[model samples]
Target: MSKRTTPVVAGEKAGSKRTKAEEPGIRILGPEEFAVLVADLLPTT
Candidate 1:
């Protein structure tokens, strides 16, 4: 298994800001990070 650092908080994007609707329990992830997360969720052989 790989090590995971403390997860990211909401609206932590490089140049993006938080929107009004995302105020409630929103967790924002970057493109690469999101891809990694998706890959991690896949089944491994």
Candidate 2:
């Protein structure tokens, strides 16, 4: 599948410290939370 991206204008920023799923006011996750993310991404493990 082709990954489509928005066209950033000149002088605009693209990267973020957090990923697309993370929202504001949320503390950085601990190991258990990160593990859940990994499990969710797996293919029917």
Best by TM-score: 1
lDDT of every predicted structure (CA atoms): 0.52, 0.42
Q: Model 2 over residues 1-45: C-alpha lDDT tens digits?
A: 012422212212323533331333334455566677778999994
Q: Output the TM-score of candidate 2.
A: 0.37
Clashing pairs in 1: none
The residue ranges of model 2 lying beyond 4 angstroms of the native Cα positions read 1-27
RMSD of each: 9.7, 11.1
Worst 10 residues of 1 by lDDT: 1-10
Q: What is the TM-score of candidate 1?
A: 0.41
Q: Which lDDT tens digits does candidate 1 get at residues 10-34?
A: 3354433344324453555766777
